[model samples]
Target: MTLQLEDEQAQKLPFDYEELAKQVIDQVLGMEECPYESEVSLTLTDNTKIRQLNREFRKIDKPTDVLSFPLVDFQKPADYDLLESDGWEVYFNPESGELMLGDIVISIERASEQAREYGHSLKREYAFLIAHSMLHLLGYDHMISEEAAVMEQKQAAVLKKLNITREGE
Candidate 1:
């Protein structure tokens, strides 16, 4: 898996945010058993920029912690066979040949605030957001109760596996 990460925040976080993103993304892909090599883009921005993105993409005029834009539409979550059957050549990068999974935009400012409000480390909050967005990229949604429960379980599992618990530093 290849993660193309960019930080656009004015004040960068003290921790190694890139490494944490990569770890969470890799763990999500592994857990989902994605067959093909994948590529994902992540941008770390501030509340103002993220709010603009949210307004443009989702028509919501508020800042959100993270936004996911999935490139491939999966019939079933994490089902690679469907991609092969459907012949989704449009979802692959010609040069890299990696499946272009999706793009993720995160608000560093919101994440920090949420971490403090939730009584967790900033690292843990970032991991949770990334994991949550990864699940969305892989065709998962939390619109309904059952789906939300599944997504919550997966996010918790990913953070736990990485030792990025709420109480951990």
Candidate 2:
């Protein structure tokens, strides 16, 4: 998997963010008949940049922890079909020769805040966010009650599998 990270604000994380992100992405991709070769872009920024993005894209006018921009529509089965099919519309990035999944934007500042607020290490919080955003890129959402349950379960399962506990174990 190709994870292009654009880290805007460099802060000392508990572990290497790139390696952790790749692991989370691998876990997500391994859950299904996924592509062995794919790409996803991640941007780590401050609250100010994320807030501007939130205001511009979501019109929220406030910074959120993370944002996901999926390349395909989740509701359609064709989205998955294209992954196996080698057609022109396979979401390929010719420049990198990898299937483009989507983009994830995360705010380090917000993640740190959330970690403290939730009584966890920043590493666990960042891993959770990366896992959560990876799922979102793979067509998971918590917009509704049922969907929220599924997503929450998936997130928890991933975290548990990775041993990224809430207590920072």
Candidate 3:
């Protein structure tokens, strides 16, 4: 698995991208069921840029901390799919090959504010968001109470493994 990160914000992030990427990839690979070689792109941008993206893609008309764009369907158990839509050919990489899983867009400004509000270090908050995004990339969802609880537990476990804890822990 490969995590391609792009920092487009002027604010400085507290964690190293290489280390963060490794941690995320490691957590993703820990899942025994996943078979494909995954590729994910993460972009850190300011509120303005993220707002534009949110409006354009989700029609939210506001900025959010993280947004996930999944490239393939999670319901199907296939290793990969080669699809042709709108005259565009999209190939889900084979299990042995590189598959573009999806993209995650994060807002550094929002993260910083949340860190302060949550009374935690920026590093911890950022890691949590990254892990959450990674789970979404891997087809984890929290649309309901039970699913949300499970996802939250998994996220907490992953964060603890990374030595990241919430404030007042």
**Top model number, lDDT:** 1
Please give the TM-score that candidate 3 achieves against the real structure: 0.83
Candidate 3: worst 10 consecutive residues by lDDT?
A: 76-85
Candidate 3 has which clashing residue pairs, if any?
Answer: none
lDDT of 3 at 53: 91
> For residues 87-152, what per-residue lDDT tens digits would candidate 2 score against the true structure?
545577887778788999999999999988999898898989988887888787778898889888
Candidate 2 residue spans exceeding 4 A from truth: 76-79, 84-90
lDDT of each: 0.92, 0.83, 0.74
TM-score of 1: 0.97
TM-score order of candidates, top first: 1, 2, 3
What TM-scores do the predictions have? Answer: 0.97, 0.91, 0.83
Clashes of each: 0, 0, 0
TM-score-better candidate, 1 vs 3: 1
Candidate 2 overall Cα lDDT vs. reference?
0.83
The residue pairs in collision within model 2 are none
Candidate 1 has an lDDT of: 0.92
What is the TM-score of candidate 2? 0.91
